[model samples]
Target chain A: MNRRRHTIPTLALKELRDGIRNRWIAATIILLGTLALVLSFLGSAPSGELKVAALEVSVVSLTSLSMYLIPLIALMLAFDALVGEFENGTMLLLLTYPVRRWQIIAGKFVGHSTIMLLAILIGYGTTMAVLIFTNDGDTSGWQAYLAMMASSLLLGCAFLTVGYLISSLVRERSVATGLAVATWLLLVVFYDLGLLSALMLDEGKYISEGLFTTLMLANPADAYRLFNFTGITEVANLVGASEIKVGLAAPLLSMLLWIVVPFLLAVIRFQKREV
Target chain B: MNSTPTIELKAVSKRYDKLTVVDGIDLQINKGESFVLVGHNGAGKTTIMKLMLGLTQASSGQVLVMGENPANKSFSARRGMLGYLPESVSFYHHMTGLELLNYYASLKGVAKTEVSSCLEQVNLSASAGKRVNTYSKGMRQRLGLAQAILGKPELLFLDEPTTGLDPSLRRDFYQIISDLRAAGATVVISSHSLSEIETQADRIALIRSGKLVACGSLDALSEQAGLPVHTRLAVATGHTGRVAAQLEPHFEIQKITDHSVDLVCPVNKKISLLRQVADLGEVVLDINMNAPRLNEIYLHFMNGEKA
Candidate 1:
């Protein structure tokens, strides 16, 4: 029992070590940090002399960036996690160990999640520090920034789970990569466009406000956007969330669902997988 | 200490959709036995190993390891005492050898301090700090062996262990296997290198197309094959023809050269052949008797199966 308890952490630490050695963690940190820095600095520039809220504008732009970048990065990190090991023959060696199948999934989840969280923190945290030092935004703007960072992490987790599901479903890493990219395209880029077109074609008759709200919360990226942009008053006013009828809890709960359901499905798939 | 077999397969069969990989086969390997499984390509040697390791479930029948159904989730306890070296051993190329060993040790619930010693045992201590990608094929194989022997597992499964090793390294590898067996560990190795394993294996199992063709010690297999032992008589410079003429009527001459004549005698008839060669004492400069080798027995069985 004690041995099983240690297996997950041990495997997680090994994954982290491999990530560090492969420079994936460093690359993610640098990628996220550079992008966040550019968006924060450029977005705050116009509001400088106009006396507009610099932090609020920066939050909106960063939230938009997170919507596209975080999920992509998370998927890239995790799409190959399970299938790559199988391709490399490590999965056979790993399975021969005393660890359970769920432990493998859980350990990878913990490791990839840690890497994503670190990237988000260092990337956005540096921007937050700079903004706080440069301008005295209201406490509400700071709170919105914090909420955006948290939701970005959650968004990454949700996609990471999706990547694991793709990894477990496929036999080859190349197939997993293709499926992951398609998943990203479907969820982040095309889903909302398709939804908008459907709504436009409906002429406001069939697609009600409540259904729209549910549809928005259905996609994790949209859920993340609503939570970060609409959950905070300062950023919510800027993004015009007055028409969004759903309470704050719906998006949050849906985001949590996005993380849990896919992850559970991944665990189930991994459990029965032959490798 | 108990008399239970370390591994047992009862009518075990494995199939991949329409293709049957392992046919119905029953086997039992007892504690501390040094067993070797020999077969040609696509002979299901690896499938048997996977079945014993519980990496793949059997399509029907049962596979028991350490007296537990290895297919069950609860069989993880048996895995702690099991060590496996896959056919094409691979590792995280980014990790140093020591780091990889340490990770496996942690997974096996062994002490972290044993990592260095394990590396030393495989003669990889000098390269322990180097990343796996920097190591040669033999080094990577050594690292694989190091991981397999880390916890001094009670049951070790090695698939083609000497695949890429040089002759000396292969000798060193079998030396390690011998030492492990001496420590009362059950060692099961599968290899196509028949002559090499012939010396170290206490018992051998020959598989052909997922079926067990023959199983026993070397001498038992030789007896079962009914192969002949060869006798070569080296005569004085001009006596080769004379010796061949003298032996041709009573013995079958397999080959003849300027200086020698070779005769094949069944295992039971070796002594009579030797006595007859002794009668031609002065003409025969020297006489040598050679027993049937493992290669011949293996070929006999493989061809017998084909027939």
Candidate 2:
């Protein structure tokens, strides 16, 4: 058991080293940082010369940005994690080592999660730091900003875990990539549009308020948007939080479920795979 | 290194849907022996290797490595004692050869200091600092060999180890295999280059159409095939016809050229046939004997199977 524990760290270190050498870490940081900088600075321009705090306005835009960007980046980073290794023939060599199959998956998850966390910190963290330093904002505003950042990380983890599931379920990298893109489109784009259309067509008859909330929680992206936009009072007020029927804990728990359930399913599939 | 068998497959078979890749076959490789597996393409060679490595499960029968069922996850401990060089060796292209070796070394629980020496053993020391993508095919093969030998595994499986290697490098490869054998390591090699392994293999297994056609030592296989040695005697300028007539009654003449007559005789009758040829005096100018080679024995068995 102790030996198995050591294998995960070693494999994770190798994954990190590969990422660093290939400039993936640097690329991710630059992409996220530049976008966050653009969104934060431009987003605050609309609330200029108003009584509303600048940081609160930035948090609202950044939450929307995080809702779309974080999940996409997370999926891109991990969609090829398992199938790529198999296609490159490294999985066969790695499996021949003393490590167990679960260790391989766990190590990859740790490595990829760490990369995502680091990117979020440097990108969004830098924007928030600048905002906090430049303007004296209320304590609630800062607290809300921190919560948004944390939940954004959770949302990224959710998509990354889903990416792993796609990777383990497919035999080829191309198929995995296709599935990943389709998954992103479904959750990030079509799911919300489909839900809105259903609500509009129902006229509040069959799609009750309770069913609407359940449908929102069904998609991790929707849960993430609700958690960041409506969970906090300051940001929620800016994004019209009065209409939200579900509580904060439900969306948060669903996010946690998104991370665990897909991860467990991936492990089971990878364990039984012929490779 | 002991007398016990390092690997055993009993009535083992592997199938993919309707296609049976490895038919019911039994094989045992004892410790410290250099065993070679030779077969044509799609002859279940790689499938059998996968079975032994526990990369896949057998459809029926048993596969035991170091007295443990490799398919069971609990037997992963035995994997540490085994090394494999796949037919197509691939590495993280961005990593340097040294880094790749170090990565595998860590996975195998080997000392970091041993990485450099393993590179040296495969004649890859000069290119150790270069990234794997920059290396040539032969260089990559050497790096593959380096990684396989890194922990000095008790049992090593090399599939087409010498593919893409130059002649001298092939010699170097066999030299390493010999040294490993000297150190009492069981080595299993699967290759298409029969001449290279003919002198090195302690035992050989031939498979065809997903079945074991024959398995034995070189001499044993040759004897079982019962192929005869050919003797060619060069006759004097115009004595070819006369020599052919003289040898026709006593021996089976394989061919009669202008200057020589070829005769096929069993191993036991070789010496007497030579004497009979000498009695022809100046009719014979020079003599040459061609012993049966592994290629011939292999083809004989393969063709015999078809018949």
Best by DockQ: 1
The list of candidate 2 runs beyond 4 A from truth reads A1-5, A46-53, A136-140, A242-245, B1-4, B229-291
Clashing pairs in 1: none
Alpha-carbon TM-score of each model against the true structure: 0.90, 0.89
For A178-202, candidate 1 gives per-residue lDDT tens digits of 9999999999999999999999999
lDDT of prediction 1: 0.88
TM-score of chain A of each: 0.94, 0.94
**Cα shift from native, residue A141, model 1 (Å):** 2.5
lDDT of 2 by residue, B209-248 (tens): 8898889888778777888878888888788889988878
Give one digit per residue, the lDDT tens place, for model 1 in B29-143.
9899989999999999999999999889999989999888887899876688888999999898888899899889988998887888888889999989999999999999999
The i-RMS of candidate 2 is: 2.4
lDDT of each: 0.88, 0.86
lDDT of model 2 at position A167: 97
